[model samples]
Target: MTQFNEDWKSDRIGSALRGENPLVITEMSSGFAVMGDTQFLPGYCVFLPKKTVESLEALPMPERTAYLSDASLVGEAVLRATGAKRINYSIYGNTDAFLHTHIFPRYHSEPPERISRPVWDYPAEHWKSNDDSYKEEQHGLLRDKIATALTQLMEEAYLEKDV
Candidate 1:
């Protein structure tokens, strides 16, 4: 099993960002999928690659298949966990050098007060802080739930030789 590192340069960083949960949420096979730290957007997720491969074609056929499967699993987990109305997936590696997919869960009346603004544009204070141990623990719990769901998905997929 590949361990997720805290260094953002590494693809495993997404796992650490997911509060150390590799089960419900994790890096895709190429090693880039992850859950963001902010609950303000709730169910926000990302898929990142392990190596610095920019284009999707850079990945081998099997890896590409697994990557898509992993992305879908994470998106499904977020939808189930948050009961989100819709899931939005984006891959704009402009701000960050690492190529990653951003999965945003759109809700009925979410984003609190700054509903009109982009999630990144909102003030940092609008989001919950990861400073407190209790907050971290809570995030860990939610991450675990998602990880569990992802694991089940993997099992089902493999049972059908879909993995």
Candidate 2:
């Protein structure tokens, strides 16, 4: 149902592709990697497919492979940039109704009990926009670090595979 309109007004993927999304770090082979709105977990990000597809099954085998591979690249870059203990990857079309992947960085410093829980369970404060929200002025450096790491990883990966 989601479509990429030219104005990039309602579509994040469209905004990202047009170089209008300030949160976009860089464009990967399969899609665009944009910074997340919340920094509750630093280095959180999302990987969006290049095209407007409702689900993973909508993509052909090659595109699907590229999307998955690029998702992993984003996770690794986040890990390298934020020193996260591990990464969490999730893709569900329920909320957004589009093809995208969420890359969450799990830190060792997280509350012990909540560390193992899904990010959605981290309380409302983490998800709501407030004083501690993503501002380019504050989080730009971290975004750049992740972008640099991701670019390097992509180069090495695609080069090795000759893709």
* Per-residue lDDT of candidate 1, residues 101-163 (tens digit): 677777878655645445666566645565422234456666666677777776787678753
Error of 2 at 158 (Å): 1.2
Return the lDDT, model 1, position 20: 58
Q: What are the lDDT scores of the predictions, listed in order?
A: 0.63, 0.88
What is the model-wide C-alpha lDDT for candidate 2?
0.88
After best superposition, candidate 1 residue 107: deviation in angstroms? 1.2
Model 2, span 51-134: residue lDDT tens: 989999999999999999999999999999999999999999898999989999999999999998999898898888665576
Pull out the clashing pairs in model 1.
23-147, 24-146, 24-147, 31-48, 32-47, 32-48, 33-47, 33-48, 34-46
Candidate that would win on TM-score: 2
The TM-score obtained by model 2 is: 0.92
Q: What are the runs in model 1 whose C-alpha is more than 4 Å off?
A: 1-24, 111-135
